[model samples]
Target: MSAEATPLSIHLADDAATALFGEDLLLALQIGDCVALYGDLGAGKSTLSRALIRALAGDPDLEVPSPTFTLVQSYDLKIPIAHFDLYRLSDESELDELGLEEALAEGICLIEWPSKAGRALPKNRIEIHLAFAPDGGRTLTIQAPEGRLSRLRRVIEIRRFLDGHGHKEAHRQHLTGDASNRAYEHVYPVDGSARLVLMDAPKRPNGPPIRDGKPYSQLVHLAEDVRPFVAIGQALRERGFAAPNVLAQDLDAGLLLLEDLGEDGVLDSEGRPIAERYRASAACLAAIHDKPFDREIVLPGGHRHRIPDFDRAAMKFEGELLLDWHLPWKRDGQLATVEERTRYLAIWDKLIDEISDADTSIVMRDFHSPNIIWREDRDGYDRVGLIDFQDAMIGPAAYDLVSLVQDARVTIERPLMDQLMADYLSLRAMGPDFDESRFLKSWAIMSAQRACKLNGLWVRLKDRDGKPGYMRHLPRTLWHLTVAFEHPVLAPLRNWCIEAGIELPESPA
Candidate 1:
């Protein structure tokens, strides 16, 4: 742990000692600001008021007297302000007589014992509570509107700067023994260095991510081919996508230290639905394809192909795994006929051709539900983040869209899909080449390819790893395949899968 990584705690002791605490709280004051100070007598309420007035006036001597029986003490400061001690006021009339509202309209006003003023004070005000600590110190609690959280963050930054340094071991103590096994373990301090969060991998580390009997899941070791993943994230961020910034990476060790976006993603706490987070995600996709990605940037992920073409052989080979492993081995006691397997391969070939020559942009190869993180703020693409982006490539523009709208993990409401697509089209004048008639055909073909690919992945995860829970997604995957195969343009392929006994699972299960 380094001193820079230490947590922050907002501590204040006495009114006369406010200068030693720092300028963070004082600098946060502004025009039309009403601050309600809460504390018992000798709790440093007047002390804080004096520090605030001196701060605003650029007074080095801190020449400010107690208002006590005088009620209000006016100050000719850099911002034309007034400091009032309303602790002695017995009635609301005394507050009105102080001209608080008038002063607020023209300049900054700092009010002590503001509760006595009641409705006379503005609702949009800062509230500060001071309490004596166990060791004769003071703790201050500041509250403001949600919009001010950013400004407050800035104040926090300054406070940290003034504190010199903090206890180093406190940060290192947070790391668990299992931390190295996960990707992205970040330590960030909060609450003025009083607490810290050790963010692990964004997604749960299900089990050891070993491959081929070797522990290959560590993100620090990067194959040369995988290096492009970092560049793609940088590019997407430049274009405005909620992609995670790489905090640190040890490519040789396959370890990646990354920023933690907290526990916010498309899914809600109840695990029921992924609504209220689709709009921004849709916008990000729209933005990616809004302007043709700079042709100069080299696309990454696969070596055999780039953004414009599909690896038909790879798709065909992957599609066969679905039947070879997932479907009942003996579909009611006999192997699938050679004719059936060949026909499905032909379907894949045709669909690949349909999108092979289409317009291309960056396609986050698996832009499905799990890869997206939801936020209702500006952090996400609008509040939705794009994760699992290492496999991104330049491919058909429809690839990512179909992946998002027709996700196999979760079914999206049809109306929502309609609105998202309409929103996308309004932003992008797609092109004469991408008319509705052509788009539907291309969408069906792409959806078919995606569905077939997912079904194969389920089989691989299950038979190869004994992970059977993934079987649940099979039915939904089949439905998407069915939708694609049944499209008017894909009717021939649809009938062939049925005749070949593909045996797609029953959905709505």
Candidate 2:
């Protein structure tokens, strides 16, 4: 806001004219920085003016067409830079009438053709003059009091667009798919509410690739899904579910701070074993199942990727991955013929169709041991907290049941799995429909789908993202697969894994 600030110079000799304007605008400014333009028509004033506005708006290709008729076109820059083209001003007094002064007071302003409003302008405004040359080239002169154009000048000298600071730097240092990449974890000071856990999404570097890799990519790095996750978290809290309260989200920065669960998870506080506590831990899952949300909430991309219908192909691929990577690798290269693979796939397809046709319910896809945290408030054993459910979906209720009963981390005792299922059905008041025989059959089919997909995912994770530690969980996942496949309900699939030579672990819970 001071005219004493310094002004930086940039050369526009070659095709670097537009690039110079972009670089200058992005680097030299923040929200609420103001700029003024001075030039003749076709003097390249509009060209440089457009570039500057686009940079602040987070739109490098933003088309800031002259507001010939509108006179003023306000822009909501990533910060807040506004652009005004006053070529159509009927008179110099028209400037004040248009409230141009107010926009300047509120944010950084860019005014084109300042001469049209000469005496009506501010006292300490920066001025840029563009005049035509004999050869049709334009000479631009930027003049301001010593401090007037300081920020804009500084931006022009920046070596990078974002200039790489704060959250941007954190992302570059942290974001990665590498297993060795330590999970970006933080413990926050307790605020009167339940303890909170905050996970900083690994910060990605500045540029185009942030949006390119796993799910989707874009020039922007904001976590597009954070909004829905926030909505669901709020909804769950309203329902009295044990989901952590999402405290705050800097979606543009992919940062979320959540309420922390205590050190005690389903596994253990120190991650050691406590055999006697197993039954109660398993019962906590039943408590969650008692409260199912039936409302369909709008998510990012609207509902294109809604559950059940959305995850069907992904679900089928989960089974296919078992056949594609894990099974073939486990067999040590004993290959199957094209016809044999086709026939085996039909079995998985049939099972998936049957499960999909079942009554749909909210399915917490990763509702297993690692996700549940223990809390002391709801009594030691029943205080299980759920996390890692950014991918919740609508599906057969049995899917998440299998996630817990046939956990990937360890096996559940047959008696315990049966007891948990019985308890869950009873709590929900479904005595007749929750028949043991029918429940177990649904559980087996869903479990097989989850297990195969999980194993396949690990393989893909290792091969694609360089995260090899997930491969260790593959053996247990195969054990679950074998158990589910062996049931008469999944007998056809069990025979496929057997003939394919994928070894199933014999470990018992």
Candidate 3:
């Protein structure tokens, strides 16, 4: 194994601080990792393990009893976790009977009294040595063998980064995430001051070239790092929209300390979309659509990122995920033939070309309910706070409008969708040269394209990423597919679905 940087040592003032440390470290774990907890009796090892397990389970009140007698306790989480206490084991060979190797292979294992297993402890693991602090507290000194440095080092880097930003003593709580590589933490300063949201989206490694020696992200103008977010949020703030203000940044590491937009969103307590909030959000979109989108946004370090246009190739490739992953999964492991794939692309090709004919503007690719924070304290469309715009691109203005009305996460009733459409057009018509008919045509085409893309995206998330919960959204997506069929432009794609025995919910049912 290659050498890594120095060991990261952390001092926790109390059990609360230990719990918080556990929460931060838990995010960095993966399957097959064995976190060996080494400490004397009552050094807060069990306390730390409980906090980590509860954080991973997303339930603070979860009961996690000591496993000294039970030996092992496993929980089925997004990443399965096995909590093991080896204090009662007589010999290292007992691990074979306890199935330690098999457990480690299947999921993350938290091993207590690892010395009981002695040399049997996994070589590739993180070892945390805890002890009593001089001042009535606990201390933790973390040591990761070089083979395990990649996991723990990132965790240490986050703490160092936060320390440099005047938030060294901030308490971090995990925020629920969506289908993105980014992880968010609600950073609350110990002084009860204003909170900040920490976005940790590291620069992704480039994949094999898919087109013109570019990966899919580059081909489609998807933001590969947080630089686009800083640049785009600045442009929006300058234009009077409410995007989170960047407080501190480490762009090289893809980390940002942003102003917390608060927990209140466009959705109500029952998770239903509020019409007034939706209207405000739609107005926000109309306001930005007329801005200068083709211009380059200045980023840090004298970097300029020109927003790429949503070209034909990018649009078609998105729909290909349907043919590539969704179709084959639906076919019970049978892959689509070359002829079927060709026909699918031909249908989408027409839609892509026709939609690209319309006027282009910045399309906040995901302007749906989940990304919009409703700040009632603010006035007008400023009340609508926009988040998650890293995937923004110069696409048809109608694309974001469609994203808002035909939201994938929440259902917007037919009447409310119609009202939002009218509100947007009326707002835009007051501005320069607005074509209602052309905009409507573009909306239909883009909405249809988005629906087709989502139909497969949900399945791909389930099969490729091991997120089967997305399958629950598949039915709503199919209903959306049928609604798009109302637009005659999508008839060819609809007819193909019929031939493929793909079920579509009866329109307006």
Query: Model 2 — TM-score against the truth?
Result: 0.56
Candidate 2 at residue 145, lDDT? 65
Query: For every model in order, what is the number of clashing pairs?
Result: 20, 22, 0
Off by over 4 Å in 2: 1-184, 187-196, 202-224, 269-284, 298-311, 331-336, 356-359, 379-382, 413-415, 428-435
Residue-by-residue lDDT tens digits, candidate 3, 395-443: 8998899889988888888889889999999999998878888788788
How much is the lDDT of residue 154 in candidate 3?
75
Better of 1 and 2 by TM-score: 2
Every candidate's CA RMSD: 17.7, 18.5, 4.0
> In order, what lDDT does every prediction score?
0.60, 0.59, 0.84
Error of 2 at 47 (Å): 47
Stretches > 4 Å off in candidate 1: 1-226, 294-309, 328-335, 430-433, 503-507
lDDT of 1 by residue, 1-509 (tens): 01121122367655545543333455545567666777777777777777666656656477788876787877766566777888788888877788888788777776777777767666667667777888787887766665443345554543343233332222221222221223222233434443332322222233455444333222222223334455666677777676777654433323344445445666557654465566667777877776565533442333232322235544555566656655543264355568767776776777677766565677776676677776655653547777666556556677788888777677665677667667666655554455554556677777777776677668767667667777787877777787676578778767766765676554434
- In terms of TM-score, the best-performing candidate is 3
Candidate 2 lDDT at 224 equals 40
- Which 10-residue span in candidate 1 carries the lowest summed lDDT? 170-179
